[model samples]
Target: MIRVLAFDVFGTVVDWRSSIIGELEQFGKSQGLQRDWGAFADSWRGGYVPAMNQVRRGELPWTRLDDLHRRILDELLREAGIQADEDDVDHLNRAWHRLAPWPDAVAGLHRLKERFTITTLSNGNVSLLTEMAKRAGLPWDCVLSAEIFGHYKPDPEAYLGCADIMDVAPDELMLVAAHPSDLRAARDAGLRTAYVDRPLEWGQPGRYRVPFEADEFDSIATDLLDLADKL
Candidate 1:
């Protein structure tokens, strides 16, 4: 029986695109800036995994997600032609720390917490997750991250590490995620899995291939609320 349900935050627990673009829109309007923030948002996001990958591979010094985001934020600010001062840009860059949880995320998590020990297992740094929990009222029993293990997802250590640190057998820990590759890694590491469909994660609704299925996981659901019901 599963006692814990660890979440993969970005697209799974919160909607990064809408959160980022919405903040960018507000900031842009406040500053009277003229630029396409969506492309900037996309480009900024494009830098994230690679940044962590470099640190994980030892190609670069160890850096947290906030630092990696700040690095990319500076790079993209010039690209987006946002002429804010350093302090303004720095404040804006930390917006990820304040992203809004998905419409169903907070309530769904609250419901799940009644039955399961819920935690976050994401590439996001601990400080990022903590600040987000404060901002969005996430009810996590504990927060786990790549920062804790000094490794990112798809690494067996990061997957198995979660199970080990939590003192649970792989079968007792279920990874609830929207990303296929992350779930695949967790499965290969012997953990149970649930694929929560988050087709709107990329933002802008559209038809696309279902990249994973029930065969890839122990269970699948349309959303966290549905996942909670199935479990």
Candidate 2:
């Protein structure tokens, strides 16, 4: 039986792309700048994995996701020749903390919470996830993150560590994620998998949807509500 449900936060539970784009647009307006904020948001998110890989490969010491995001933002700003004060930049960097949840996220989480212990299993740091949950009204029984385990998802240690910390066997913990790569890694680590589709996660129709084989995941749902039903 699945006693715990661990959610992947960024694209799955919260709509990061749209939220970031909105934040970038506000920042651009404040700076009297005109640029493709959509592309800027995409570029900022695009840097996430590579930044994490740097730590995974021992090129950098373990850094929180917030710091990684700032590093990427600094590089992007330099590349775009956009200059802003430290306070403004810091506020903008915190856009991730203020991301809005998907339409079904809060309600669906409440629904699922009735049946299982719900927590975050994300690469975001503890403070980041906590603030996000607070801002977005995400109903999490607890918050867990890469910072806690000193590893990121797709790493066996991260997956196994979640199960360990929850005091559950891998099979008893279900990893509900929108990313196939994350789900696959959890499955490989002996956890059950649930794929929640977020077709607009990249902010375009069918642009970045990952294809998966039938039966690849233990459960597949159109959204968190459907995931609750499936469970």
In order, the Cα lDDT scores of the candidates are: 0.86, 0.94
Model 2, residue 7: C-alpha shift (Å): 0.5
Model 1, span 50-157: residue lDDT tens: 888888798988788889999888878776666787777777888898888888899899999999999999989999999999989999999999889988887888
Segments in model 2 whose C-alpha atoms lie over 4 Å from true places: none
lDDT of 2: 0.94
TM-score of each: 0.94, 0.99
Judging by lDDT against the true structure, name the best candidate.
2
Each candidate structure's count of clashing pairs: 0, 0
lDDT of 1: 0.86
Please provide, for model 2 over 1-231, each residue's C-alpha lDDT reduced to its tens digit, 9 standing for 90 to 100: 999999999999999999999999999999999999999999999999999999988899999999999999999999999999999999999999999999999999999999999999999999999999988789899999989999887889998999999999999999999999999999999999999989899987777888999899999999999998988
TM-score of 2: 0.99
**Candidate 1 at 63: error in angstroms?**
0.8
Candidate 1, TM-score vs. the true structure?
0.94
What are the runs in model 1 whose C-alpha is more than 4 Å off? 206-210
